[model samples]
Target: MDSFPPALLAFNLLLYLFTYVAATDSLTAQDPYLKDGFSLVSSNGNFELGFFSPGLSRDRYLGIWFKNRRGPTSVWVANRNTPINDSSGVLVMNITTGNLTLYSHDSTAIVWSARLLRKIPNGVLQLLDTGNLVLRDRKDENPLNYSWQSFDYPTDTLLPGMKLGWDLRNNINRRLDAWKNPNDPSPGNLSWRMELHEYPESVMWKGSQEYFRHGPWNGVRVTSRPLGIAPILNFNFVSNEDEVYYQYSVPNKSHTVMVVMNQSNYLRIMYLWSATERQWRLYTSLPRDFCDNYALCGPYGYCDIRVTPSCKCLEGFKPRSPDSWTAGEFADGCERNKLINCGDEVGFAPLNQLKLPDTKRTWVNKSMDLEECKQKCLSNCSCMAYANTNISGSGSGCALWIGDLIDLKLIPDAGQDLYVKMLASELVKRGEVQKTDRLKPKMKISLAVIAPSLGLAILFIGLYIFKKRSTVKDDHEKIEAQDLELPLFDLSLINSATNNFSIDNKLGEGGFGPVYKLDIVFGKHRANGLGAEGQTNIFEALE
Candidate 1:
């Protein structure tokens, strides 16, 4: 090539570098470089990637989100902290060095990059069906050799198949950080993480300080957030002696799900294109009502949304400050009506639709039975409450809380049941037997009346059908003289005639009646079944 000016030569070299990167695996790949652009698509083509500006922010950020989503929401943001000022952001993976980097107008100025511990001999960045953007070595064909993955660092949104804990061996911990605002992709002060310590529980941190806690793994849910435990959001514990990690996934393939913490620290789960509503629907949320705020009613208090006054003191417990409680200030919590003497006569209080307390100062035994858990809690004077850790089985294991029970909520269904340890003297103080008889008899009486009524209905229905069928021959003869003869089609004949009532035939009657109307013969001639005087079945006539 002919010698050129130094500046022009440098510009040409930069152009060649961009062109080469923009060409390699630039289309139909997980991470595609589109000439001057780039896209990250899931393996099953469920999602796509491009430059997105969250909300009203003009700053451009690279993100991957559902392709045909009802609402375009970025699930993962690459340059969240350092957004490009304009639409000129380019993402490319260097083929030789296996380094994936985002660029601004200046080719050498790196905007964001996946800091890899080691270089992959033949690496390629791929977006998996799980919504994880992973860097894999092509030649190795081993999943264990993944150099880096987007799952390790989550923005606000928690996608279907992302882990949320630490792998101490590899130093990878997938954690979620709230966004600065609705439109800004920058990390917010509130961070949500699965604490691998003690046991896996989702912990919310306001900076370095732990603000709220989702209690330890109860085999069903985090005790403090029983509502967060859902079928759509399947929690998983990855451990095998050496290390432990926690993650979640959406079991249904047809369902598009995501959990996002808005700027206000409200975690919301949304579903896409629900069958019942035929639109995107918000399934559930945390801090949904006032009760969700961590320990709104302080120690020894429970939040019951059903009551006019949702916050209430546990049985036999009185508010520390009666004046404050009446004025809607419950930070003083509640004091026991009678102090526990650790006597042999202590009992447990059954609380329904209540989320279990926090687990930070709690004790757990994964193998202890519910009864054993109860006994354990009773033995400890400080243990305020106890619950079965695994509700899936015969309620195996124990979770006992000794400190203040925080973030209690009233969930509709699937709320963890907590047995509050109370002194036997408290039962006498509250007049337990008097209240039990008042409430228990109504439920029993209602069931007793309902069960017999249902049985009587079934018996009456059977007798009526029997009597009618027994007199069918006599009724048929009586009607023959006055009623017209009607052709009764066989089930198979109707099925074959209408092709099993295919949807095509199910709608719109043709000018000649139904589209698949067929002629039927009785004996040797085609029969006109309509009588001169008899009426049609009113139901079919209305149809």
Candidate 2:
């Protein structure tokens, strides 16, 4: 063989290093390091792994991207928040433990670590063509048998076969959160998560508040999503007792598609890669209208984006703050026109064909029917509303609300009916009037108790005035008594009314003076104040 020069030998070695990266897939303990210049390719040569700088940023990130691709496309990132300052970073899978770590220059500090739960002997870190970077045993290629995987953790992009939901058993929340900016891959304010409530729904949140909801996943599709099943796209939702998630897969691998929660506009943009166009084409973007915004119409307010002024209070209710509501800020929501008094005085005003309210303060009884749910709401004075949890098959299950109803909107041919608790008088206007005869007995008893109580209340006020005038001893405090509302009271009459302002009659004390009751609780009973213990149930704010 002819003697090769040192320069020619060096060139051949560099060419071999580059070629080796394009062919290799699995990285084991023996081959622990993949340096900055080297890359890891998927078994099918579909995806590539390397340290790359995003956009104009000087900081480098350890990421996996489409093979032969350049900028504007990286699927997943490991050290997104903590970027490597230079290109001297290296990926290392420890020999003793099957742990993957990205290291800075000179292998001094770790930029990121996988922190695998179980150590697998002779384990391999393989980048699958499906874009899942998993740590599994070489003998077991089964995805379920894997000890650790990158699919559990996600970035802005949700790829095919990637789950967007929860793993309750492991407390792993598989959700998509947006990047801080175009260049920065750090988590932003917007997030996409499955709201596993009485009815499991996919909602996008801006911070803690709901920004948008895909509507709940009905049997057909997300109730509000305009997208339909097509030849290229396949949608799936799996919700058992343990885990609940929404996964999308492309049956034809040739068709490229992904859902990106756009950081700039907080829009969940579905994109399909067009080989013809040589770029990603926008399939759809959600929150297409002002009505799509979470709680766009506020509490008990129904929004109709088709209407010019969409925000309008529900029947039997009015805007809590009309001024703010009219100004296009309907967040204050609406309050009842007639406050419900529980029992027979209340009837349900059934609002149909609308998005249901937020379920944070909701109580669910899966076994209860719609009628049973209505009865349960009526029994509890705190319950403000109730709705069917499942509307697919005759609506089985109950969802009861204890507080304000919010984020409701009109979606024609979509959403379930919400039966709001309202006074019978309010319900009458909506033709939902209940039997008023059931309320007559309570009304009669209330009036009989109130008549004598009103006369005693007048007498008690007279005593307080006399006591104030007589007790004023200081020269500066000496004030004339004005004969205004109440009839004059003798000392005997005043003493009889207040029980001599005794400890038994002492209602409570405030900044003005101590308040005394005139047998108010025992109402028109014996002169002796009996059965009145602890603080009186009678709440009086005396002037």
Candidate 3:
């Protein structure tokens, strides 16, 4: 090879150095990001913004992704829907329009552009440590007052500090749209957004239909289910005239967490980065089980995962179609066994540890107490159920459901209470049944003690009667044997002997009366006796 001149070699080296500087530096109105290895890296070196291809596809698109990760894990895509066929893509800030625009270098054709309402004269684009690609004025340091930010237009994943809700003042609704597939970054049919109603709720949608619902905020959390305190994480929700949004943050920056809406399985999953495992660990997921399905048990019926059938009618309610319910079809829901007369006495039966029902046709009073809520519900005949709006501290506020209660579930350790309205007769019957249920265990214990005592008493009485009869029989037998053993005397002989010797025989008075001596022999025995009047007495001394 021929050696280059000294000056030419030095010039070539300087040109290469300039290119390197352009590739790594932040973007400004004067510097355009070229697809030729040019990227804007966050100050902390945690994130990078540039043009890249996803999966096996050769198409190029501008996106922001984690820099330290093993592979390309894109967090946000700018031109996901539009792909550049070649490596001629350029991301440039238009100074005149105050917009960030992506264009094809060869044809100079615009692929995508950020639409801004007001023009910014001194705009600077920078990627932040929080994975946010922001466009702001050169003079402003406040991130909240940014001209344009990727956080406001989430693609799929919700990183810490990203708001997923509405900016009422700007009329912008921030939502998450899942990717079409792992390889394709285009928006998918599945999405998650906030449903604004009298009581706002976070809802996941499969196209236009509601797929899953996170029950309305009850002052503490977004859903009715309690999410215990996570020392590393903090969740926030704001609802006022200016905005209504929900966001989460990691207090410990060392720990990373993100929520992803998985399109393949139609699931909203939360993941925590594990430093020891070097992988994202699944923390939890939404639509947690079959019971989490929206309105799976229909109106007036609640789903319980702990039960076999899962679906059950609320108190004072019966299946609308018994046959259908038995066959596992619960869409028909349930009906009040005894219809309530609006003018008659009624009561509220409380169902504990439950996910509050839907609030489409509902009313709320932030300052009202639970008792006041009950009276308000009773005044409105259409009201089906009521619950506390806020359950923090001594629970405050009131929320009443006016129509049929829908999408109820039993979330055992982590849910609120819902009081359902019922007629006086039905309440009385329910109270009686509840009373019986409470007494069942006590009744069992009482029977266990009394039954054995009664049996022992009956057994002792029977033994006493048997012993008395046995003693009487034995005495009678003894007397009969003694009488048989005694010898018999001839009454006629005794009478003649006593009459012939009456006065003479009375020689001496005895204790028995006038006595006389008599002698008799029978067989081998001889007897001596004393006769008095018409009787004879025998003595052992004479014998």
Candidate 4:
């Protein structure tokens, strides 16, 4: 041995290490090394792990993925932050120390390792059907008594049994982060995490900017997500002195499911196995539109995708930055029409058919009823709104919004109701404003029926009410245009006004289509100033 060269000796030691790691075919303590030629397959054969490359990238990585899935479906990577340069990588575990380590081919470099906290010496490493790589005591045989597991450390994808939250005892924050891009499994800036503050809630962030939020769990569902279709499975959120985390389970064990943070964007996409298609089918997707953005409509503003301008100041509110709104930017949000009187002077304005606002600033009481929630909110000057946290069992529990309401969106026919605090004076203002808007079209149609003299009177009648308020003029015009869609004019009226488009009323044609002139009169005078010989130009509708 003394005669052997130092380089040759090192080479011989590396050969022994490689040969020792590759001794076993099954994934266990006896079998330390898993090479490219073989894989560590789950008990049910739903997943496999080995050296593999994603997309067309030349780099090989140690990762775990669905056995049947295709096209970059790896859920967890042992070497995510660090990539292996070649296929010369092997996964190994020390049976004595109970440390799962992956090394480079030559056995010279340690790539990644599972440094578990509690080391139970005699343990076996096995991949379970739930896609968890665990270290179990060879004698105990109970999974719960395992020393460690890979489920606690996740990458971009969340399998059915995996969690997305925190482990308080170990002070570890479990989160789901997206991949850098389609071809790379490296961690990206976008992440979906739980903010365990005053009220725990799920938030999606791109860098520091919030992209989407799942309002506090109400024991039934995410208040931010209205259940359009009944759920097929159950979602669980557990919080105690020991731990706080979110996880989901399927009703049937036969069905396979996964939730992935999509590579192209910051949306969470849910996929399920489709036997017919032989691939993962999109079960559902989140943050579907601008309304889904975290606090997208801003403070005191509401979003409705059905309307042209999605963002609008809630009733009894005005845009804080009119210029920002004019430019189609709404992050600055809206201001209250009247300052809060505080205490009992303020009244609760029930906002129905809308997604609840942010819950980080909310205060929750599990034992209170809706009425108790109302009384509690009404008594506190800081409380801006309140709602039943859980809508089950006569809606027990209270969730009070103590600050500005953010990320409110109308959910068409269904949604959670929010009773927002408002000045008693403005409580009737919203109803009055809505009533006025509804009557405007009727008023305009009725006013259009009258002669010229009364038309100004009707327009003045419509103008004075909103003009007195501090609401911006441009916003009012836009609102009118949006809410008032039809002019309610009949074809016969146009035909009558044009005098059946006589040759005398005919006008020159333009590049778009044809143009025509018309003369119209009302009962006593011209209709809105169509005088004795007044000419009205009717142009063809341009495409």
Candidate 5:
């Protein structure tokens, strides 16, 4: 082959270098990323932004994924809903609009575009190691702020450090929506978002209805359960004037973790990549059991998995519909057994190891103590329960719930205590019931020890009476058996009146045997029973 001239060869080498730079480097206003093998890789080489088809899909999408992973793991997709049928796609920064636009098949048709309020003359689109694809002004030195970012519009997976909440100032809600299916990148009905209420909480929705909730943040963690111990993962939640968001991070770089809202089973799952297993192992999942279903036990009721028929009414409450409740249908919930008198004396009944009720109608005071919380709840007729907002250390902050309490669950080890409001009379009755319950075991033990002793005493008296009867030989001492007439009393009736000859009713021990005083009145007659050497003699007399 003939060698090219020096001038022509130099020009050809420059063209190859330009092509190589465009494929791997960030996309600037001047450099457009083409669909034909061109891509952008993060500086740390952890993430890549490119145009590709997901799974066996022939449709192409602009997305970000792990750079050197075994299989394609797309974290964020730009044109997920709209895909290019052919490979003619280009991602470029429009100079006039100062926005990142994706064009598919034709230059006139726009597939998906990200807009910025203020136009930047020198805009640059870059992919970060944390899997965030951002468009920022080239002159800006701060990496924290971005004109537009993929983290603000997450798809199925919630990568580490990505905010999953609202930007109040801009009215932007950042939430995770699951894909339609394994092969499709379209948005699904299942979504996980931070709900904005008096007390905000992270909730998962199945379309318009609530499916599950990771209870409100309680200064430590979400009140529903502990995410995990420290050192492995650190979860942060912030709520203020401008923004409210929840984010989690793995402290150790060796550990790879991601949260995905799976559409197939409608589950929010956290997966940790296990190096030993060479696969993603399930770390945790929400809606863990049947009790995790939102409002499964309805209002004023709680679900305890340890008990049979998990749904149970709270103290002072009864099933709203007894027939329905007995049929295992808890949707009707529960109603107060005794209605509360708002002006009358009232107190709080503590329910322990419980996942706090829904906070739709709630009030919180970060500086108030638990006693203050109780007083506040008591003062408000609508307030049904109160609890310490933070259970760390001695516990501070107050959370009061108004209206009917819903979605209560028994969390056992990782649950908070809720003080439910009750009438003073009900409180006293509950106290007495508890006292009786505590004494039941002791009562059983006493009966076990005393019953045998009483039986032996009766047996010994019977033997003495038999010997006395055998020794009686005088004709006048032995009464004529034919003329003797005595009314026989049922043993059961005698036992009932003397309370089974309880030790409490025992008078004193006589020469014959132990005597029991039975002042039981039968009709117009009073009967007294004496254990005279096992020949229990009953004497009836009018009172």
Candidate 6:
């Protein structure tokens, strides 16, 4: 047999490398263990999770941050409440209790732990490509017997496969809490939880007060924030014999999503990259506009971001205080033009393209049809509105609202049609008044021009005042110093410096001016210590 040359051998090695990469790409959950402080790189090597120290702190923390995430975007944090003071932290599973514990380098301190009541024969923690960290039992390939997992306790980020509701069997409530800051993984003031009070609603809160709500679940999506039901997202509500929990995931299984409660109490969804932009981009955010604030338009009123003022009363209602509304204060909300008569005398107005209101004090019937729901609301005068829970396949369930509407958002494609009850006489009066007002062309034009012109004038005046205040004495001092430090050069001196700035000597012209490279001898170095090359002509300036 003839031996291959060196170049031929190198070519064969390069071919083997490509084949190895291709083979690794197809592997998934094929490994049994990810050792302590070591990570199993994603098949694509786009993400890695082990342990890292954040910022200037020496404390070691176990977290799963994006391998290419823009500047430390940690999706999940383990032991956030207990950060190891040094590199002594080691994550290991105990065989006796079947618990996952964080210990010191010398195995002295148990800094943090995931408590498990039962003992497992053998266990090892594994990091799945989906960014899920699970403690798996070696005896069985099934994950049903895991000792402890990060999905049970979430930090700020909501990954695609994680559940977000209560587990009735174990009485465990899964919720996402915001981090203290970008650098610190401590719990913060903001928290997002799926409330199952009367109806299941996802809400963000700043301490005790509710900040924004995503209405009630209408089977397919949350009625208030229909964007949550986009094609990329799949909301799952499971109440079965074993578990009762709500989980959501991005439809594209290959991609990873993290819906996080940001430090500011805003719900944000970030999508991991594939090839386009190698960074996580913010895909969606709640309270995206002013209208998303809790009860911004008050009772009987609705907030519309499309409008300049963004607050308006319903058709059959008028501002409670005209003066307060004009002054940009709307706490008083709106009052009914006529009282509700509670009988067949009431007429239902179809509020199209709207997010159903908060359902904290509401009722839901899975078997009720639309006609049945309407009759139920009609019978009880307190039922302000009614809508279908599942809006697919001719609709199947009913969600009824009893209290004032709160945190309603208007969406185009995903919103459910809401039927609001109002007095027939009030509706007729409003229609007639609108017809009468439309006939007055002069009044209509005046309102259109005067209001817009006033707004423009105010905007221009505010800009002028800001410019005036910005150019004070203190600001001028900094500008003056910066100008003095930069030497100003004339075109003539620059021309002479490079023989009329010849093409050969010309460097490059940028935003400032053309720069020319000059070669000028300082002094005559005629042997007898004539100060060698004296001082080279090293002066430089921008003209």
Q: Which run of 10 residues does model 2 get worst, by summed lDDT?
A: 534-543
Tens-place lDDT digits, model 6, residues 58-149: 77787777676674467787778888776666666555445676776667887777756356645655566666666666655575676666
How much lDDT does each candidate structure score? 0.70, 0.79, 0.82, 0.77, 0.83, 0.70
Cα lDDT, model 4, residue 52: 82
Q: List the residue pairs that clash in candidate 4.
A: 21-33
Give the per-residue lDDT digits (tens) of candidate 3, residues 99-126.
8888896638999888664677768777
Question: Worst ten-residue run, lDDT, model 4?
Answer: 534-543
Alpha-carbon TM-score of each model against the true structure: 0.67, 0.73, 0.79, 0.72, 0.77, 0.68
Off by over 4 Å in 6: 1-47, 68-70, 226-231, 239-246, 264-267, 341-344, 427-543
Best to worst by TM-score, what's the order? Answer: 3, 5, 2, 4, 6, 1
Model 4 local distance difference test score: 0.77
Error of 5 at 154 (Å): 0.8
Whichever of 2 and 5 has more lDDT, that candidate is 5
Which order, best to worst by lDDT? Answer: 5, 3, 2, 4, 1, 6
Clashing pairs in 3: none
How many steric clashes between backbone atoms does each model show? 1, 0, 0, 1, 0, 1
Among the numbered candidates, top TM-score falls to: 3
The runs of at least 3 residues in candidate 3 whose Cα sits more than 4 Å from the true structure, single-residue gaps closed, are 1-25, 30-36, 224-232, 442-543
lDDT of 5 at 320: 98
Residue 523 CA error for candidate 2 (Å)? 91
Name the candidate, 3 or 4, with the larger TM-score value.
3
